[model samples]
Target: MESVSRDLDMPDDSNPLRRLSLEQLRRRTSMKWRTYPHDVLPLWVAEMDVPLAEPVAEAITDAVALGDTGYPAGTAYAEALAEFAHKWWGWGGLAVGRTAIVPDVMLGIVEMLKLVSSPGDPVIVNCPVYPPFYQFVGNLDRPVVEAPLGPDLRIEFAALENAFRSAGRGSARGAALGAARGANRPVYLLCSPHNPTGTVHTAAELTRIAHLAREYGVRVVVDEIHAPIVAAGASFVPFLSVPGAENGLSLMSASKAWNLAGLKAALAIAGPEAADDLARIPEEVSHGPSHVGVIAHTAALRDGGDWLDALLRGLDDNRRLLASLLAEHLPSIGYAPAQGTFLAWLDCRDLGLGSDPAEAFLKRGRVALSSGRAFGTGGEGFVRLNLAASPEVITEAVRRMASAVV
Candidate 1:
């Protein structure tokens, strides 16, 4: 691992995705690298194929050198996020007072749900979203209601309105929670720059959502972990920055952009109207983040801008590269260049792979990808490919996938 790091210690302007060799990546034991046989090209999970940003690596190293491993404390993580948001997304409204540090984005979401809802109450989601949105919400005993995205992979207001109304309908669970919380409002768990498809919601779309949530008496909680991974010509609109969203909540982190997922830490931010509810999150939840995770996240938000820019450049190139490769070798597969996040959602129905093309790719092509079936409704006959690897590897993966069909 140390040798791999040394090989990847390139200038900030260089493409980090191309720094490490395939042999070096094989040395990794992370779920992404170790889940398949050595011959398979792994492009399934959210993990990035890059080394740590210099500032993030240094921060973690310095903390360990000083033996400063202790429980997380202070608001440095929130403050750093505020600065980053203000500079990058033009979001100057991130209130540190309204933020709480949680173990990770999913856990923070679970905690937030508890504040505005009860078990068995329906929690709405844009279908074919992150698989964990279903797993975690269901585990909490809260039923998930699908408001599947439109054919364009963008939110369909009519579908969302239908979900909100359906979730608001009287039920044993809804009546119970309504009586206690003063209203039987459902919670919409939105995935901005949505997973698999990578659709970045426009500000107008978000403002419309906020209006609908208000009209329908619904609560909105967003996972903005991919906020920083957006490509050029597109912008990320922070949910809390738009009008009518003063009651919405969002979870943000530097973990995704900086490849610091193993170091678990994320901030749950409340809108001005939702601060009291956010405060109700159990005090013990604050203790869940690692001191090291906080330090690394803060450093990444505060000083890793250059490294992140380099990564976005590499990912932009890779997205275009994947499009061309598919057009050349696997023209039957449907794909749109992702607007954000290093993931590609492929329409494989045309390939006759029957529901999950990823299975065929892994078995016949020795390439591992995420099965779209796992993403829920509207995900059938699709697959998700990770685009955060070297151009060479991405090209090879496309060749392998094409060969699978042949």
Candidate 2:
């Protein structure tokens, strides 16, 4: 990997693009005191410390200039999404007609939950998952069934099947009642290119999961926000694209990949039966999507490909650099560059961090990162690091970490 000094075309301090440096990001964002101090590097949050593409900026400016900030008409946004799906994922001219566009990823998940299940129902979640998955279920009074993970953080199929079968009659009853009452239950929240761990389930794995869901008569709500940012050699498999996954629902967004998270645009693609159910969700949700979000998302889909490509290259390089650094400085730590997502799950059990290195890195090294415990049971003794920043930022983070551990 090239050094930031050689590779990056440093922006002038006067330009917003130039202000994208770690120095400026610390000043502009409130992350300074909370995580990375003025001097320490930050590898914590999912947000990339990068500037918006010129096209994206232009679209937002153009929208505001025209005073067109009112709620967007659904047709154009839906078409833009359809085009992106076909162009990128080979989902072949799949039309997303009159879909309910929510404010953000979590909101979309909640909406899917609303469409499928009622309060106090059961939601199946894999352990060592993104923390929000647990909170989302708990907030709704939904009993969460813990699905243990394999050593690699991939789904333990046998355990998941057992959980689905014997998770309790309370769970089974809810599913059956939801099917009869026009509400769905026992929904499995599937994370594609899963967060924290960055494990991308293969098509075969997804097929097996779908078959199990089919046999158990449960619904699958897949969160695929990280699909667009996968490493170059990796291909993302959309759960709905797999055969026998006809009843599954897919959730995606430009937020994670394109750094449009604050703009709050996300999509929910449901199969035939699921789509019908989503369409019948209260009309109030029809307006949940912001006009600004739609505008930003449309612009990103229409003209953001070059920027996305560049980002993928930059992220891939950063991922490799960190992996290499870990291999050299912390030889005892074992990890591979994840096939998708900018987040890397560092196995720190060899370091003897005792289940929470995130705290040690912060208190001693002044480097802040998400604790593995935040992900769930199996996440202990590991740490999740975001490598979406400039190469210098990532390099500095590694340096700080090395100093503390050694």
Candidate 3:
């Protein structure tokens, strides 16, 4: 563990994001750095290359200082999340009583899925979604159907309707009811502020999704880990906040915005009518979340807003810098600037890099990126780039990419 600088205290006006030089970042022992050789620049994981938010750091440090590391128990984390949601998204309907602590976003999503559907059921998802959506759902023995996004990177309701209808075609019976029409329901694993693409879904789109779920006997569970990272002109609509979303559940965390993924804390919130289903999760599962994670995430939600805002500003600059770099060095690679999270999805089909462009980038360019093919349908000839690095690193990466293609 390297010593974090005290300069982490929020400066009145300075780009905190770019402050870390390459040498300093390498000192980190995390998998993001240790996975690749010394020469390779690893940008495949969702981890940001910025310093931890001061409040989150202090919270963890304080807990350690007091020797408070133990099993987690309480309503503090849930209440903090409720307050943050109300203050930020104007989601006034959030009830702390309806929330449950989970180990992390993915695990929470898995648990929520179990509550709504049984094994051998059907799970619907948007294509080119987070790879874990496929992995986790399959782990539960559920069938997955894809609804690819439209050209504008927005939800395609027609595709969703087809998948929803298709997913609900089995005969009525215990677990089969989950995928059966006229009774029971299938699960729609939605990724809001969707991963890989970073497109912030609009309220109208969410409302329609909710209505579709209602009409087709489908249950909705939204992965909203990136909800708090929305940039200008884009507002995140909590799935539970939609009119017809009373049967949906949303999994969120302070991990993404505050860069606290290692903390291992997350929450699964249910809509008014669906709270009972989520409450059925066994108490034994609650023991999975770390006590330190609760302290760190609670502190982040309650006091890390200013730090998050500063991060959003820096990420905004980094997003534009990436666009400029791509335009200057690899004009043929199509990039749609992300509206929320610090991720850039590049269209590399034109580069003739075969099915997986990340392979060429890693081997020839010494830069690691997330391969698009693993993201399931509609992902061929694409790659996901992490835009959470310093401007110099981003520029150097593009330069290397250009060199590889030429």
Candidate 4:
């Protein structure tokens, strides 16, 4: 691998994404780097091209040095998250007693779905979302119903209500029992600071969703892994903090914000009213979290705040940089600045790349972007680019994409 030094456009030294050179990043054997050929500028997957936070690295190293590898134990993860949440989002209601440790965000979401809905029940998701929402829910034998987001990439309340009604038809038992029971109800899997599009759902939107869920006897399960990655103007509202959300469940992890996805640990938090439902989770599910993962995640939530802030700033810069690069190099492509998450959803319909623009980018430009079709409805003729990279790489990716178009 050839060494590539920092570009003048890179963020300041405090930005973790700028810490590693291209060669150093290529040395990583993670899915992000290894999935593509040597020449391909991979901007797919959720992995961040950044070094681990010092606190996270230290915690993991110390644990390994002490040979402290064992099954996860204690409420440390939940407690750390509570502190982080309170400090960052002004959420003071994270009851550690109502939380459970799960392997990761997606698995935690799957388990949460199982807790509220039975096999063959409908699981509703906003389309053009994380593809796993469909895969995991389908693997559990639950059918996935799509409620596509509105043109603004925000949740569509009417579409959501329609999905809720459609899903409720199959759960007559739950609807008949009313919202209080919440048994045999359809599960609405929400991606906060939504993936692909990076739309930060406002508190008002979340509260309305909670109200609708209550009215339709739909259970809301939120994937809040990107909770800590919101940009400056956007506020991340924990689904559980909103009114009428006492029956909702949320899965949070420090993985996305801290770039600790390889270390699998997440928290499944229940609303006060849903504690009984959470308690029904299989005990074996708790065994899924790695002890080291717990330690790393705890350290991240507790001690990695400054690093997270720096990363967010870097991401903000990268998102803006991408906008300029696209405007200059790929002028026909449409991209809205993301409110959160390090992903950019690009509209490639005008590029005439047909349904899957990622294929053309990969083959012609040697740039790997996430296929929009895999994200389901409203995703075709689009591509999801991972913006958690050096400014130079992002620039080069856009140049390559433009070349492919030409």
Q: How accurate locally is residue 78 in candidate 2, as Cα lDDT from 0 to 100?
A: 65
Task: Indicate the residue-level lDDT of 351 in model 1.
Answer: 91
Better of 3 and 4 by TM-score: 4
Writing each residue's lDDT as its tens digit, candidate 1 over 1-406 gives 2343444444333888987777778898899988888888899999998988999999999999999999999999999999999999989999999999999999999999999888877899998999999999999999999998999999988899888878874444554566576665579999998997999999999999998887667889999999999988999999999999999999998888999999999999999999999989999999998899999999999999999999999999999999999999999988999889999999999998898889999999999999999999999999999998888778888888988996
Best-to-worst TM-score order: 4, 1, 3, 2
Those runs of model 3 whose alpha carbons end farther than 4 Å from true positions after fitting are 1-13, 169-184
Please state the error at residue 396 of candidate 3 in Å: 0.9
Candidate 1: clashing pairs of residues: none
**Each model's number of backbone clashes?**
0, 2, 0, 0
lDDT tens per residue, model 4, 179-288: 45644568899999899899998889999999888777788999999999987788888999999999899999999999888999999999999999999999999999
Error of 3 at 381 (Å): 0.7
TM-score of each: 0.95, 0.91, 0.93, 0.96
Query: Which candidate would rank higher by TM-score, 1 or 2?
Result: 1
TM-score of 2: 0.91
Residue-level lDDT tens digits of model 2 in 123-185:
888888889999888998888888988876788998889877754234445556646766535
Give the root-mean-square deviation of each candidate in angstroms: 3.5, 3.6, 3.9, 2.3
lDDT of 3 by residue, 1-406 (tens): 0112333232324555776767777899988899999888888899887887788899889999999999999999989988998999999888888899889999998899888888877899898999999999999988898999988788998899988777764322332544444344589999998998998988898999988777677889999999998777778888889899987898999888877888899999989899899889989888999999999999999998898888788888888898888888898999978888889999999998999999999999999999999999889999999888766677777887887795
For candidate 4, give the lDDT of residue 255: 93
The C-alpha stretches of model 1 lying farther than 4 A from their native spots are 1-13, 169-183
TM-score of 4: 0.96
